[model samples]
Target chain A: MTPHLTARNAFIAALVLALFLVPVYAVWIGNNFVLSLFTRIVILAIAATSLNLIMGYGGMVSFGHAAYLGTGGYAVGILAFEGVTSGFVQWPLALVVSGAIAFVIGILSLRTRGVYFIMITLAFAQMIYYVAVSLNRYGADDGLTIYRRSQFGGLINLSNKTVFYYLCLVILMGSIYLVWRIVNSRFGMVIQGSRSNDRRMRAIGFPTFRYRLACFVIAGMICGLAGVLLANHTDFISPAMMHWTRSGDLIVMVVLGGMGSLFGPTIGAVALLVLEEALPYVISVAGRVVTGHDVATAKEYWQLILGPMLLLVVLFARGGIDGLLASLRRG
Target chain B: MLLFIEQCLNGLQLGLLLFLLAAGLTLIFGIMDFVNLAHGSLYMIGAYFAATFAAMTDSFVLGALLALIATFLVGVVVEMVALRRLYGRDHLDHVLATFGLILFSNEMVRLVWGPEGRNLALPSWLNTAIEIFPGVYYPTYRFAIIVVALAVAGFLYVIVMRTRIGMLIRAGASNREMIGALGINIKLLYTLVFGIGAALAGLAGLMQTPILTASIGMGENILILAFVVIIIGGIGSIRGAFIASIFVGLIDTVGRAFMPDLLKLFLSQAAASTAGPALSSMLIYLLMAVILVLRPEGLFPAAGNR
Candidate 1:
């Protein structure tokens, strides 16, 4: 087992190395677009990783995870709009509100199991989405623009691309390290044990609800931090950030990168986002070669490929990209 | 008083519409134990079919009938091809696969019909409002929707309670192995059950097309509401679905209509106005959360064997 896990560990280390080196490569090549794109990818990777902590290891599938993204974004966007420009205040506020909402949501939703849990999480998220839409003061359905991004007191500049990229990378690495430590800790074992068999855990005299709920909040808090970065990355916030589809996308990333693995979320985020960007061009080119016409329609149908691909993944590749890679390494 | 009456009536109408959508959902979920996120896509397809066929035939009734048949066929085809293989699998698998179906169906509709929404015109005869009382006026089309939905509800009740096929469905719901033991062609029954569910969702979709234009995302918004109803009603209980659907419908419509006014009684006008719409949208969800906390199996969780 030790020998086998070495391959997986090496892969994760290499992936982290690439993440740090990306901005360097981008700066050297003067490719600002790739830098910005990877920055978004990195932020979402943090969110996906947070989701993986609960969904993959802890076995709680909260479909409303994007609510944290919205809450965190709005915390900054609304504050920035109301003249709170300090990152010190805005960032912590983002974390607190997301944590609070997740606490409330986790408490309420954790009562149910299975499909009910999925639907309840989804409903709660929709509630938040509607609330965002009703915030006429903050732009309502049109969404809000953060005229000024959160400012740090001469310590680090978020407005600088390379500096921001490194900041995100460091935070992401820190988060992963945190998750790794927690998973090996006693609390994580309880969460995992509960996920596998809550009844058995209870029979063994463990009070699993508080542990799971705490896990839920931690995941939400981490995702909330990601949301802050996301709002900073985009310089905008909308109800669209919390839409159930975005939550579904995060889930897809987790599942595709391989659930129940340390590096799955990061891999999933990169692969899914890269595919989204590339599939259109690839499909159009293929269409041009095959159909020799309807190029525009073909490009639009990239989602057509995506839908079936997801089905195949669920049916045949449940372990996702990370799992596949691990298996290949073993062979 | 008149406004209150009107809003209540509107709530009832909306509730009945939601019931039409929820009833089919409960049946499919309760009987087959499959989760189809693409259920809404079928609703969208039903509306699109109505729009296209109505345009072709220029008669609302004929187009509707054709849409129902088309939707039934589509549901049967989907069940046979994709969903049949997924029975007894993990609900997560069902969700992911059906989510994929949603993407497929939505894009297919966009590819086939273009992204712009299509509108269905009500017949000129049913276009006007009728005064049900001395002062209360309601649209004939809306009144028609209520009557049609009620009829469907009655039809479902009678079929489920009184017919042999209904007996088979109930038995299957409670004991899947028992149904197979009884020499039932489980495949055919499942397909037929799915057919009825598809037809019901399609009917709801097509019926509401004249009220709201048949748009791409119509089914999704209401689908969540249907889930709320189902969650409140209980996952596999049609009876629970009926009660929960109307309750959600009333709470949603009535809450939205009156919440601002209610908020104004104590709060500043500006504050009330600011919080009203957002608070109103949250009413059903609040109700759902309360129900989940209080009764996790839902109010009328089917007394199935599981």
Candidate 2:
């Protein structure tokens, strides 16, 4: 096999092993809560993967994908608050609304290119955030809570940790698989070709706008699914889910994990959330051992590190972890 | 009728503040072709500086002046240290790097000032209201903001149209390579331009301190509005920014003040109450979308390029 193909297969094998092993390891160590965190990682991985489909493959950088998450979460939260407990209904509603919002926003925003596209998407997300905040009847700025997870015809128990973890795992893997197929399909080739050169794609007798718009909508719908899972996981949905900063965090995950790759978002989500959980304590311990002073508060400033890290990655490591691995394999 | 006039004045005041922000944003984009998201950070810094300096000297005017100078220097330093390296890079790179600076500066502020917002109280002399008409009294400080903003606008007009440096700036906006070919110190010019832009943003922030709460993320809300202004006015066009800022400010202010009542005419009180604020808030963006559809280059594009 060619090294590229060998590298790709090896990466896929490593990911499968890591996914199963990490959770098993968590259980073996009696740190069962890692399952919950990993579930979150899987859910967000789905969201970021959706984002990568458009941003990495279609050259459409949306800085407002968190809106879909919020929309999805709000769909579940609002319905639960109003006594709609069916998973089938709630999930489809989330997808449809997210897609509808994406279609509308993309129609207007896609008219602009580059920075304007980014800014307009951001503005639309902010608009939705404001709408969420204005809903005083549904808890407003504080967010609404799902009294119970969605019911699945009395078959699947969403509240069980193991079941929920596997459910998220299945969805995430499914999303990655779907994205892989979409990116490699004829339509996918058109999208990537548009990313590489939109003018050329247009010149080659392809009406590229519709393809890009469809890609945008699909990505939005996928993120919306993650949002539904997130609400179910947290049992709450707040306007914070859709905040611009949250959108920035998603972009960070996509870039850090390596954009455009199927498993990049999965790896990124795990790494970032884990770092968030562990970094503060680690810093404090390291600080105490070195200087005999408590420095737990340093974790509060982790964003300071992350921001510069993003810059360095952009400037020096444009390919991210996935790119780094591929280059190492080539060498 | 008097209330309408008062609201109009409020709109004008908000417009002037937005113009200060949009002018700087457009200039930086127009001339340097650099997308600086951290421009809002400059606004926040200006407000913080004003609060600190005013407290130290117990004189609002003195504090504001000091804040302006300090913010200008900070802007120049940031340009030299971080932004200079970003020039000629992709827009995405500029966004990422500046976004980093935003994170770093925000944390630094939190470290220095803590999280809670502080009040930059107006001086006693400027605290009183002045009767503008038979049935209307306006805050003297707000009137001062309008007046100062207008003066700056006039000054900006003269600089862009009549001055030698303004000529170079305009030329640079239209064609950077040719101006560089003419042997102008492009780096120095860029730094100066950025410093001036920062000063304008600082002036807006400092002036608004007495009226609004000075806080860590205050620049954020207004930054979006400024972006809207720049988009409506067309990027790189100061005159367009000025006109668009006033229009947006008017639309936003009037829409917020009256949209709920207007909505009540059609929808039930509950629905109107919910949708009123949201729809009104989206008016400016709707305007931007329509503009993008009809006039993608904006009403008055400075560079006039596709």
Candidate 3:
């Protein structure tokens, strides 16, 4: 392998190792907060990874990817609220519902190209969000609280924090592997081909639309799974979970981590969530040095920096963090 | 009968406001071929500026004029400093970058003006209810908004259809390369178009501020509505945006007003009450989806425009 490949592999190995040891590290440090934070990071990482499948690889920029997250979460949340706490039923139903919604959305939105596509997807997601908001029986805008986690017939005890963390990690890794395989397969090639040049792919006798639709459904299903975990992790499901901004967050993760790379989304998820957690503190420290006061409210303005940073990244660092890392060896 | 008239008037008022926002958005999209998700931020900024200016000057009219000019300048600066570089980039890049702008705008607003919303109070003359019919009355401010927006729409039509700059804009929309090749200052034209768009959005925002307080993220929901307007009306088509904005505004406003009571006639009260708001809210999107399925090019496809 080339030095670039070796460096990337080493980084991935180190990342995986760090993730696996998070629980152990948390325990040693006597900080349960770290464990829970990592759990959220892993779950969102799964979401960003699925978004990357279509966005990075398939060349579909889905602005409303978080709609599936809400669908999946609401599936679990509504079922559990109605006393259907079985994981088997809830998980499958979440996947099916999200997939079905994705299929319908893809059919309509995929008809339009460019800005129209982005707007349509956003509108569809908003429609779902409003629907969720109007469901008064299921807690409406306030959201529903899940009292019990999904029961897997004693196969896995999710109540254990360590078990849950590992479960999320494994699912994330499995998804990354599945995406890698999909991109390498014939079907994957067609999707990528369509992304690069749809008219050419169609001229070559490949039905680009159906392939893209299928890919969209797959991404939706994976994001839906992430939603299921998110609901369980937080024990709440609300329309807020599927807001357009949340969808924006997932896109940011995919873009920031380095699109199309298997581990980019995961790295992005970790980096973003960690930054969100740590940025306020960083700002406050810098503020203290400059103003000589705590600058208590400085933490709230982290997005001020983040927003421009994103612009800079888009304008200059289009390859994101993964690309940044890859460039390190050359430099 | 009075309620229906009032609702219709409300619909008309909303449609006019939406038209102002949609017109600018379509022009920018048509001429520049740039996808700006932060158009909504300009709207929000406009409202905030109006509120601050109005509060400071204690003269609503003067404040509004100053706010409009400020918003136009803000738009120009935004185009020059950031968005100008984004031209010819992928639509995805535009989306991501503008999405960042939205976040930055929101946070900056919060930092400058505390997290709470600002209310733009109308003057006594504008705030009073005007008797428009033998037994009906409507708020003068709403009436003023309708009149002002309609006048602005007319002004836009005159400029686009009758002016030399309008001809250039139309030409640019149809064939950007040819115009650039023909020695037109395409950069200046783009900056001018972007500024005008920002002004329109700000006008819409400022006008609505009296009715709905200037709040953070307020532009987002309405921005989506404008998107639907453009989609149904056809992107890059001013006439399409005008017709679509009014159509969407009427459907949304009237549907929300009547849907719950109408549903109650067929279904139980509780079910109607719950489904009414949801169904009404979803009406425009469902309409957009159907239009997408039926006529993906939208109702009015601009000539020689993608």
DockQ order of candidates, best first?
3, 1, 2
Candidate 2: where is the Cα deviation over 4 Å? A1-12
DockQ of each: 0.84, 0.63, 0.88
The parts of candidate 1 lying over 4 Å away from their true place are A1-10
Pairs clashing within candidate 2:
none
C-alpha-based local distance difference test score of model 3: 0.94
Ranking by lDDT: 3, 1, 2
Model 1: CAPRI class? high
The better candidate by lDDT, 1 or 3, is 3
Q: How high is the CA lDDT of each candidate model?
A: 0.90, 0.87, 0.94
Lowest lDDT sum, 10 consecutive residues, model 3 chain A, at A1-10
Shift of residue A34 alpha carbon in model 3, Å: 1.2
Q: Model 1, B1-306: lDDT tens per residue?
A: 888878887888888878877888888888788887888888999999999999999999999999999999999999998899888987878888888888888888998989999999988998999998899998899889888889889999999999999999999888888889889999999999898888888998999899898988789988889889899999888889889988988889899999999999989999999999999999999999889888988998888823
Q: Please write out the lDDT profile of model 2 over residues A232-329, one tens digit for every residue.
A: 99999999999887787787788888888778877778778888888667767877888888876766876667677777887788777788877876
- The per-residue C-alpha lDDT of model 3 at residue B160 equals 97
Q: Residues B185-295, candidate 2: write the lDDT tens digits.
A: 999999999999999999998888888867887887788789888877888999999999999999888888889889999999988998898888888888888888898
lDDT of 3 by residue, A157-239 (tens): 88889999999999999999999999999999999999899999999999899999999999999999999999999999999
Give the candidate number with the greatest TM-score.
Answer: 3
